[model samples]
Target: MNLDTPIEYLKGVGQQKAELLKKELGVYTFNDLLQHFPFRYVDRTRFYKIREVSADMPSVQVIGRVLSKEIIGEKQSRRLVAQLKDDTGVLELVWFQGIRWADKLVQPGAVFIVFGKPTEFNGRFSISHPELELYNPSAVKQGNLTLQPVYNSTEKLKQSFLDTKSLQRLQASALEIVGRSIQETIPDYLRSKHRLLNKADAIQQIHFPQNPNSLEAARHRLKFEELFFIQLKLLRNKLLRTGKFRGLLFGQVGEKFNAFYSDKLPFDLTNAQKKVLKEIRQDTQKGIQMNRLLQGDVGSGKTVVALMSMLLAIDNGFQTCMMAPTEILAKQHYASLEKMMGQGFINMALLCGSTPKKERRIIHQALQDGSLNILVGTHALIEDEVQFKNLGLAVIDEQHRFGVEQRAKLWRKNSVPPHVLVMTATPIPRTLAMTLYGDLDISVINELPAGRKPIKTIHLFESQRLRMFGFMRQEIAKGRQVYIVYPLIKESEKLDLLYLEAGIEAISREFPLPQYRISIVHGKLKAADKDFEMQRFVKGETQIMVATTVIEVGVNVPNASVMIIENAERFGLSQLHQLRGRVGRGAEQSYCVLMSGNKLSREARIRLQTMVKTNDGFEISETDLQLRGPGNIEGTQQSGVLDLKLADLAHDQHILQEARDAVIRIFEDDPELNTDKNVLLKEYFLRKTPAISWNKIS
Candidate 1:
């Protein structure tokens, strides 16, 4: 069978089996079959006697003769008991609910090789459900043994007689095809410099390694190619964006920027804020389309920098649109910007999805007539019906909430794609920044504003809940607002929300005074209700806001001075930090209370300890990246974060840097991979994979 042929065309695969394989393993093509590498390997070459087995070891292999085999119970819950004896000692082999088959296979006085984890039960050593292979004395004496590969299988596939062995047979057939069909993808120079193996060799070694060194070499080669293609795609997009798109040339318009800082501003800009603003100004004046990412910790003054850039767009007589992920955030930006720029400094309009049709029509007419200077909204601003008069800049807040196509729609609203400025409160690790946002310029606001007190973070066990409540009462008595957050919005399949509900009910019981208002917000609440609840908190009408992570992104309450997160162990470090950021915005001395349960894992304890030690977002992000790895740093699919299959953004930074350098060097020498020896390299990128769509990359 050819690598490009349908998988059903392979030997011994029928229609029903092909459908099951496709659904269970995503194997529709021969190429897919070849790439299904084993999760782990079991070495049969190292065999230990029964007496040499220890309880502390994970697993062991033994060869012995079966002295007796019997069923211990009724047919429903029967167990097979086999007593095996070796020259050293006798061992018991047990299998649950499969006695009939075990009885037929293992007869008295028959020698067999068994492999399994040894466990101590009732003061006796036993191996439960050990895998058995009939022993051949002559073959065993020859020392001819192999490593057995284990693959992840589903229940349906296993029931259909497509277990690991069946899958291995299919893989063996596919590998034979790959050996003759597939070609090497890396150029000779790169392969030699990196000491890499060919594609076919790497695939074979990864599945059936001769030694650990071979496995390492196979892994390195595959990971390098995966990362190289990702970087190349990002770099190409960046090059196309800068070379093709036109941006408004607002050269050296620091007068308006200075005016806003000197006359209209309320607080002094932090050094980090100043630096990021300068970067934005330079990008705006360069006349090239600005695809920049504004990354900072929560409450690091990203909004102020965004507003300053919007003002620059206004000064250049070009209308700007700022899109927020939610209506509450959009409204918050509208109120804050109006307060900063005065009522009529710029004609600002809010065009949300829920905006009345009459108001939307008015906003649409004003935008097309060049009357509205600034517009803020949710996804409504990107509707095709909404036209812009010389749209110069598009600012997206909390960029992780939107996809690439969604952002591109906003750009297409204008004649030429508007200069894009994406902002996020989530601090991205440096390595992930290189791979995910390689097409964008990065500006980080690492420092908080002056006079803003650092939020004191502390972790308390669940047993200390009462003391935490008492402390909360004291903080409330001192006239400071509090935010008590839960990790879940409601009951889930994986987790119970009983603790969260109990905490909310307990707070209500303790603080029953009508004079003190308590508001609730969660994902299950309707959008309008959620917005109203947040508005109450923002207006200081609610002294305590009980919420879930729905408030983690854009609910700005400067008056809220305390944040209490229940079951903090359930959250990632970055999430805990973001929730803690809800407070400490005001001039008050804010505090974060992390309540965790007992018996936290080592990684969980480290995450909590990191939260208690510092408030720097960048440092916390680095710690989070190291602890959780990059696969989960930005969450999974629908999270707008790049999903890398092999490259660990935390551990693969050096590899990514080298691959980026190589790509740059190649382009500098030859714009296209058209050289005689580089042909294979070009063909490799054209091949499709499960993680990335070919059309998206091409």
Candidate 2:
């Protein structure tokens, strides 16, 4: 049988078992079963005495005789209790489930093997629902395995009598059926040079390891292979894009750009901004398509860089567009840019879902006639009715919120394709950026703007509500606005909204409406209503804006100086950082109060402490990566993050770096992979191309 043989064709896996495997573990073929490596290994070479079994022991195995069995309790409390003796001592074995079935096999003086965790009750040790096995001296002597592999199993699989033991049997059977016949995926030369185990042996040893050393070798081989292919794929795409596409040339910084920079620029560009602008200029001048990711902290001047880049396009007589995920952010960008554009003879328009039909028509006409130099909007910009005259550069804000297809639509707007620049305020950990955005050249705005005071972060318990409220009153008295952010947990959205409404009522009582002028906003609010509330807050018509996480993205209000986050512990570290970013935009010293309950988990405490300690986004991102794995990071869900089965991005960075370097070396040897030594690499990719790859677009 081949590796692709249906799993049901195996010796013992019937259709029933095969379906269970597929549904439970996504294992449908022999190869899949083989690749489903064990999470941990247990030594089975020795057995412990019953007398030596302590309550503190993780697990223990003992060969004993079932001396007595009795059905204890009744109904839901029913249990099967038995006394087992192993020459040294008598031990209590109890089964809270399957009493009828358990009482039969375990009878008087029947020799059996028992294994489970030992727990003490009333100073007596007992095993609850221990795994029972028939003792066989001949089978014990015949078995050559020194260690046993433990695999993850679902409750449904266990219910079908297909537990970890059954999974282990299937793995062993898979190896036996396909043993040496398991074809290698990695090239032999690379494996040999790297001292990696062959694919076949690695698969076998990973399932049933002979020793710890061999197991480690097998893990290193598999992890390297997984990460190696990914890096190769991303790097290859990057090289292909850079070499293949000829971008629109914005050769020189012209009039509009010069006018805005020298005359109307608010503050001198930070060195970080100048470096990134230089990179863009260099990329644009080379006539190669630019697909670059610009990462900055929340308050970093990325918008300014984007504006300057767009101005370069305008100077070269080309149109530009910037797409934000939401209308609020779109309008915010439009307003900010309008103020920045000032007296410059630059024509810009904003288009969104809420744009009036007349304005949309005017926008369409301006865009089609080449009068509009820049268009900033939401998904409405990509609508069929709205088209750019000569699209030269497209800047996608919070790029992860848009799908590959959406971004592709923008790319297709121009025949030669504009230089695509993706801007994200979410600081990506270096390891994540390596794997997720490796195809795009990354430039980070590591430095915050000068003269901006760091947000004063404080952690407080719920009992300090009076203090928090009084502090809010003090801030409000100083003519500064306040933002009270409440987390809208998805599982209980309605409950959270109700809690938010209750909070609004309480705040009104405390501050007294008419005089307080608090604006309430949440996900449930209608778009028009939410916009009205947001506008009210932004225009200073409201003293406090109470909202959910909806405002976490791009609601820019320089006057809002204090941010109060309720249930701060419920928010992720990156999320807390983002919410805190809302306040510190102004020159005034701002404060972020993280209000949480009394009880806090160790991880939650660390997250709060990290927030209170530093204002560096990269540092906070690293801590967030440690506290909550790479999965929950905002944009990485679809960026090859889930495909990782074994490699820990937080800890296996060394292996990832090694794999990346190896890919580079391969490219250096034969860029096209046409050489005899690299043909296997191409073959490997041909057999395992992903359904959708991020390398295709920004």
Q: Going through the candidates in order, what is the number of backbone clashes in each?
A: 0, 0
Estimate TM-scores for all models: 0.91, 0.91
Q: Write the per-residue lDDT of candidate 2 for residues 1-698, one digit (tens) a residue.
A: 98899999998888998998899899999988888878877765568898788988877788899888888888898888899998899889999888878877888978887877889888788999987888887783622336788889999989987888888988888899887898787788888888889988888888888887888888998999888988988888887788777789997888888988888899889999999999999989988899999999998999999999999988898999999999889998998898887744688888999889989899999999999899999999888887888999999999988887899899889889899999998898988899888889999998878878999999999888899999999999999999998876233744333257667778889999678899888889899899899999999999999999998986999999999998898889889889998988888999999999888889999999999999999999999888778888887787554488777788789999989999989888887788898888887776688553433432
Q: Highest lDDT, which number?
A: 2
Model 2 Cα RMSD, 1 decimal = 3.3
- Candidate 1, residue 56: Cα displacement in angstroms equals 6.9
Error of 1 at 616 (Å): 3.3
Error of 2 at 73 (Å): 4.4
Predicted structure 2: clash tally: 0
Instruction: Report the CA-based lDDT of candidate 1 relative to the real structure.
Output: 0.82
Residue 102 miss distance in model 1 (angstroms): 4.8
Cα deviation in Å at residue 213, candidate 2?
2.4
